[model samples]
Target: MQEISYPEKIDPRLHIYPSQEADRLKSRLLEHHETGILDAIGRELFTRMDTAGLVPIFVLRGGLALKDAYVEAAGFGPAGVIVPWRARHTEDPTVSYASLPVVPGARYALVDTLIASGRTIIACLQALRVRVPGARVDVVAPFLATAGRERVIADAADTHIHCVWHAEDVDGDGRMVGPGFDVGDLVLGWQGRHLVWSGERGERA
Candidate 1:
């Protein structure tokens, strides 16, 4: 079993929970086709996050793969106010689709499978600022790259970021290196193809 490691000193606002299951899942992500394991890991992560009083409100398109698990672990109903968001471009991400509800002063948790470049999450934060001003947002993910962590902290200093696993950095293609692949694409059935939305609303360019 490969041991999980972390930096000597991590950001105070960033929370990382090392899990043996997550370690196994990371390896499985490279070879497995089924998402049941991913769902299981997501459930555990969300369940742990529930203790922090985080409420599920917004989820990115790739995060839909773990929606069911989050809903179950967080004890939220299927009809909960979890809005789906899409961010385009890594250089300067822009929200393409997100029906954010106006909830000033409300604290929200934004969900995503992984944070590689941090551009997508940054864009989501920008959109939330416009649609739901004065809202406090905490980002949740199963895995996070070191570069992404630094970028998000620098860009959104007030945001609290949580992750179950950590990667040393991102690869040239902007995928987490420890895992060496895109978790979102693998679980969402878009492996080896460009990452795009593929849910009830269908794939968007």
Candidate 2:
């Protein structure tokens, strides 16, 4: 078996995404809902976020990342979750950016399937600040990369992160090392056409 590396002091905000514990959680979630286990996980995530006084906003990107966002929002009950703004950013240094319309002094919860280097989330938070000024933001994801987590922690002081698992490394394309696959790919594939991969179980793809 291959060894996986994690942070020395594991973050309390981080939860194990793929493991016996998660499987057990899934089993418990299934007692109330009939959707796939991932959706069950999304619903569970919403419950946690609600306890924290946060709302869910699905990222606009396609695939499981977006699906998980919708699923989380749906789990928020009748009124649904808030999606105050939608913005996208790139890594290109020469590119210009703009902020979207936001409610001043409002709090938002950003949801995505995975975090690679934290660039996109940072950009999104920055844009939100432009519109809402003192807006507070929380990021939620099923998985997060260590480098990405560090980058966000260093650059964005006010933003909170809630994720189920953390990995040592994730490439620019979002493929995590040791696991040797991307959660986005697996989740999106599962959501789209019923494709399945070994990485969902923490096995190399």
Candidate 3:
């Protein structure tokens, strides 16, 4: 949000150990940076990236922002409906699909808020596999929790991550503290088929 000049390569965080002040700041970031830039990223994907032979995946609850961002910035293909296994024991939201099955010939861009141990993303990805075996896909999460990214990379060797930012703990204090790492500040545009880089000066230069 602070004039994103480069992509951040800071390590990601997996746990949610937010302090009150951090919470307040995160709230502000949500209002200003996270939400706004999401729209910008999705629009860029639509107009700049190839969208012909892929599916847009929106995981429930958290996927709302990604969905809105995409729709507002760049309406891609028709979204194939899917909901994640919500954290157990909460009153259920009205789910469109009582049950969903993976359908082949489709690619999924798994959408979510941030990565954490990839429990959520892995679950969603597995569910897609269950519904349609061998479904080709990528993930479009808003940000990459540094901790989760390693596991994601380990679990799905071929999985791709497109994110607005990549948060990390530079001090190695085991928490995302100090100046927040901004991956967008390091790279610009799609860096590879699996990941896109943005906010980096090298690209502009």
Q: Which candidate is the best by TM-score?
A: 1
Q: What is the lDDT of residue 61 in candidate 1?
A: 52
Which residue runs does candidate 3 get wrong by more than 4 Å? 1-49, 86-104, 169-205
Can you tell me which runs of candidate 2 are displaced by over 4 Å?
Answer: 1-35, 51-53, 62-105, 172-174, 178-205
Candidate 1: residue pairs that collide:
none
C-alpha RMSD (angstroms) for model 2: 9.5
- Residue-level lDDT of model 3, residues 16-74, one tens digit each, is 22233334444455455554554445444344344555567766545655566566555
Give candidate 1 misplaced runs (Cα > 4 Å). Answer: 1-9, 51-53, 77-90, 101-105, 178-184, 190-205
TM-score of each: 0.77, 0.57, 0.55
**Which model, 1 or 3, shows the larger TM-score?**
1
Candidate 2 residue lDDT tens string, 67-179: 54444554442111222222222322111333333444345666776666676667666766665667677777755778778877788777777765565466555444443
Candidate 2, clashing residue pairs? 15-164
Q: Which candidate order results from sorting by lDDT in descending order?
A: 1, 2, 3
lDDT of each: 0.66, 0.50, 0.49
